[model samples]
Target: MSDTPLLDQLESGPWPSFVKDLKRVAARKPAAKDLLKQLDRSYKDKITHWKHGGIVGVLGYGSGIIGRYSDLPDEFPGVEHFHTIRVNQPSGWFYTTQALRDLCDIWDRHGSSILNVHGSTGDMIFLGTTTDELEPTFAELTAKGWDLGGSGSAMRTPSCCVGKARCEYSCYDTMDFCYEMTQEFQFDMHRPSFPYKFKIKCSGCPNDCVAAVARADLSVIGVWKDDIRIDQAAVAAYHAGEIKPRGGGSPYAKLDVKADVTDLCPTACMSFDGKKLAIDNKNCNHCMHCISLMPQALRVGTDTGATLLLGSHAPILEGAQMSWVIVPFTEMEPPYDNIKELIANIHEWWSENGKNRERVGELMLRLGMRNFFKSVGLEPPSQTVRTPRANPFFFWHAEDFEAEAAGRKYIKI
Candidate 1:
């Protein structure tokens, strides 16, 4: 009989199955075998039998190693304390062969040997390990120059896309910035002292491969504020179909220079007269549509920088929100003092006003952005909102209106 009859059903499908991998792990790790049994019971019962215990880690850190112990420990003794071990991955998830080998070797020695490529928040996740094994496992990884990611109410591990390493469109060195950010905020990452978790993600350009705008609390995306540099000859090549649109990835049957490039522009600022191309640079929104289609012809402005957006989060307290512009554009020079100051100010404000378990975004929502902007010393721009709220909401206190007008005709409430 199959150990996991229900789980084996998943294997029959065309896609590869984790159940198959679990069975493989079960062969060597007793914990995995029992885990399968517990899962079978879970399928039959339709209820969770796992409970969060006093999980701990090696680095004298109290968080990051997340686990839920089996409630039916007597029945599934081998899988009693399967904790998740989160390793702080390198920027862009780039790892050499030796590094991967080392991690696999450590997992084989002390863990269930099941691992995730990376988690949504950007940590390289080891799926199964005992609480006692965490210390030894992390010790070996650290010796090989790796560390733990964040969890609980602290800042989560920061991440960045592969910028200069491979991407030609990179406006800044995203990996370096992300690395420095990780280092600068080490204390926050290790210590669980925030009202809620915080995430920071960087993208080399507005391509946003890291989904920074939608996923990060603090989204740093590369941008250019000046004119789009245009090369006439390259533009002619693209217009003539001599150069394929994004190397032949367009949905259009034939590359229609007008339909694909000029007309589709959000600002409608591009014009091509067959052999000649013209762009109204001042009207350009830097949407990257044209630049992406004709990379050789249209290049990002020389005055490259990054845009700062804040308060974006997944649906939990508030609905899923994309980041809004905080700073429209700023040169992200090394020793990034501009960003450092803003972050310090934000943290200081949030630490004082944020409620227990409330996200910084929720805090801003509660207090209202006007007051929040005043407290943080930020100039709220039109770019802050896609469109001005038709119905504006505010939180006015007793002192917001004059004491003399309390009973008068002027109604502040």
Candidate 2:
């Protein structure tokens, strides 16, 4: 019963999130006004629950559909007013001042000024609007050549790490693939028919600059069949104290002679020459660090592309895991039809067999990767999938139904 407002009660703590946003919108948005009023009344009345206006959705778009909430029974305050839209971001994020201004002008016309630069999964999140405005907004966007992306239960937006355009470590073109997949998988992004969420990410190297290991369902990584690049001049620069390693997240803890980066070189491409270095293309791992560290002296070869790794979902499906090269490397040349075809194969497989709330990783685990491979009609590649458990459960094609003991024997071990 104190004089302090209910908003103050909710906003007093460290994660005073709603309060922070409300403060910014209070003067302009009537919806913010209603939100504060509802919170205050709920606090004073000690009410803890509210109901939603019956399920509402966008006409053509699916998933990213959100529910509407209300405090008053049978009354949806500004039912005509709530809207959410997603804006795609440019790869590498280099925005011109004019581009920024143009984007703002569009938002001011169709949405509230408040904008979340990027959503938790990394797409521009815009909030606030009316139901009546959706089609109009979408029409305007399409006419301006802008399009919507996935949200809600559909496939989320695809993301990529800085690649060939900026980073020296890039063995493949990440931006090209990201944009290509964005256009090719329009159905997945626009519709909602997945067991759970699907995410795609591309990285310039094994370093996983985009955190695809933790977030994405399918991860595409740049790799090469060749060896690592070594520049004696660059290694000398490091020794001479002229070059400094900046990114703290080096895969190798500390580059010392013992690290044997040269010996461990996948392509045996790197060798130290009397404190100098040399790169033999025949054996480079395409790990990119040595080249990234010495851009002037080292670089990836042309003919480089990416490997499509699959079934890397969040811990829910399996413990935190990285994707495995299910399809090995493919040509990432412009007009990425190969990548698109692969995506179609995966979606068809999932839609036919997956159950609700079951992620692709979980589906693979239950059906056995061998069955998944056979069903997808793709030839299995060596080292395609890695299992932490050395001896996992499996069923053999030769086993007979009468041999119950044999089936149970593998389980006993």
Candidate 3:
């Protein structure tokens, strides 16, 4: 009889089976075998065989290792003391071949040899290891210039997209920013200072290749405050179907001027009269949609900056919510002092007032944006002119209108 009969049943369909891989690993590893047995038992009982609650980690570190154990240790001896480890990845996700080899050699020596690539918090996920192996593994990793990523109530490893390194649309040096932020907050990342976990992600532009807006607690998205740069000749080329829309990513053979470009502008700030493409730079919202579609014709403005947003969290205590803009724009330069000061101040406030396990986003929701921003010394930026209420909802304050004012006139919004 198959040892993992119920687990084997999962291989019936055409889809690739993790059960197959587990079985393969089980050939030489008792933990993998026990893991399969526990899974088969789970299939029969419809419940997990693992339970949490073990405070285990390397010396002098508060997080980065999560301990787990089997409820039936006698039935699954190999997985009795299995724990997960979060090895931090470098900025820009860069790794030399030797560095990767060093990681693999250490894991193979002291752990289950199971590994997962970059996690949401940007860590090399080492799946399973025993308590005995934890210290040795951490020691070896540190010797190789590697360290554990964050877990529990700590600052997570900061992540960023491949920025000025390769992508032309990148408005800032994301790699540099990520590296600096990591170095500056290594203490918080390892020491567990916050009431809950805090995460930061850098997106070179609103293309947001890292999805920072939807995921990170603090989303730093690149923006340009100046007018979008236009090349009339390139616009004519696209209009004459001499260029492909969206460059290599385009599925369309020709640029659909109305369908793809001007009409799709969030603020309707662009117009193409067949011969000429005109943009009302004053009304432009810097959406980046038109620029993405007509890359040859349009480019981001020269006045590069970043937009800071707060309160984004993945579905946990509360369901997933997108971040809201905090700083509409701020000029960025090397050793970003202004943003760093702002972050430090936020940490001071959040660490003081945030409840256990309450995300910063949730705090913003509970306290109301006004109260939260008031505590942090900020105000709501102007909202979009067209139906800002249902959309980003800038009509959040009664102060949005004066005490005795009859009506409001919005110019830039």
lDDT of each: 0.83, 0.67, 0.84
Question: For candidate 2, lDDT tens digit of each residue in 1-413?
Answer: 53327677676787757766765675676656555566666777898435433445567877443434554623336323456677666665556787667666676676555567777556666665656656666676666666666775568788888798888667688987888888877788888778778889888777778877666888888876654444567666654545554333445433442144466666665667548676666555456656555455555665567777877765643466666668777777878876777777787888789988777777877887776787776777765747545767645544443355566533211
Separately for all candidates shown, the number of backbone clashes (residues 3 or more apart, or on different chains) is 0, 10, 0
Model 1 lDDT tens row, 1-413: 97568887888999998888889889889989988888988998898878764646666785578876899999999878888888998998899998999999999998988889899989988877787888888889889999999988888999999988998778888998898888888888888888888889999888888999999889999988888888988777776677777756766434677878899999998887777778888888878898888777888887898999888887664579788787888898888877877877887788889988777777777887776777778887767765667658654556656644665543322
Clashing pairs in 2: 64-151, 64-152, 81-129, 81-130, 226-284, 227-283, 227-284, 228-284, 267-283, 267-284
| Model 3 agreement with the true structure over 54-87: per-residue lDDT tens digits | 7899899988998989888998999998899999
Q: Where is model 1 poorest over a 10-residue stretch in terms of lDDT?
A: 404-413
Evaluate model 1: give its TM-score.
0.90
**Highest TM-score: which candidate?**
1
